[model samples]
Target: MDNYARLKQVWIAVIYLLLLAIIIPWYWPEEDVRQFYGFPIWALLSLSGLFLTSCFTAWVCLGREVTKE
Candidate 1:
């Protein structure tokens, strides 16, 4: 596989991990962890990192040229 295809696969994996981080908590028993700025710590940190990483990935991907086979 070429670089573009590889990068797309990696991006999809990152998105899958992000979704897992967002949803896996629902199956766990509730516990009160220390809040970050009045929001759940996981939501604040995990989602912020996910969004930033996604933005950076998109920015980098925009400049790449995918050659046809």
Candidate 2:
């Protein structure tokens, strides 16, 4: 409920928004066909983005301090 906490939350939200943007393949060309390890290139990128988002969320959750009010 303090300024620092609010700022931190805003930064976290911005990062999450960026990650969400990366997870979507809107930038990939529709006609392009490429595969890596049996998976499409876009699919691979999206999956990796999801993985990074998950890791970031876990790190934020696990590293936060709990305060008793």
Candidate 3:
């Protein structure tokens, strides 16, 4: 792999780490009870993060070039 490819992978990994952090509800307050669209706010936020991660992964996978070695 080249330097550019390594850098790209590092950036992708950072994004994924951010998504993972968002998906985890460790930051939400335990006693707070907020709701949105009938679901808990934290739950919705986690779900949204998950959806975004999925979309990002799909975009990356589908948009990547195919190389024959």
Candidate 4:
């Protein structure tokens, strides 16, 4: 993959992390809603999103190579 495309992926990773970080902290502590499998519902959802996004990013970054035109 070209360096430019790789750089874009780094930006994407940063954006995703920033978004998740902002949202998880903002939403997790509100209302004290019950726990799912030992975690608040919001926390669980955030965690799931993080995990899935990681898997997807790895799949996109490693499973396929981007070529410059």
- The best candidate in terms of TM-score: 3
TM-score of each model, paired residue for residue? 0.45, 0.87, 0.91, 0.49
Over 8-41, each residue of candidate 3 has an lDDT whose tens digit, in order, gives 9999999999999999999999997999888999
The digit string of per-residue lDDT tens for model 2 on 19-55 reads: 9998999999999799998899999999999999999
Angstrom error of the Cα, residue 22, model 3: value is 0.9
RMSD of each: 4.4, 1.3, 1.2, 5.0
User: What would the per-residue lDDT of candidate 4 be over residues 1-69, giving only the tens digit for each residue?
Assistant: 999979988988787777577446674556687887787777777777778777767866797767799
lDDT of 1 by residue, 1-69 (tens): 999889888987887677566644564347857687888876676677677667766876796788899
Give the Cα error of residue 42 in candidate 1, in Å.
1.7
lDDT of 4 at 6: 91
Task: Give the higher-lDDT candidate: 1 or 3.
Answer: 3
| Cα lDDT, all candidates | 0.71, 0.95, 0.96, 0.74
| Residue pairs whose backbone atoms clash in candidate 3 | none
Candidate 4 — worst ten consecutive residues by lDDT sum? 22-31
Q: Single out the weakest 10-residue window by summed lDDT for candidate 2.
A: 31-40
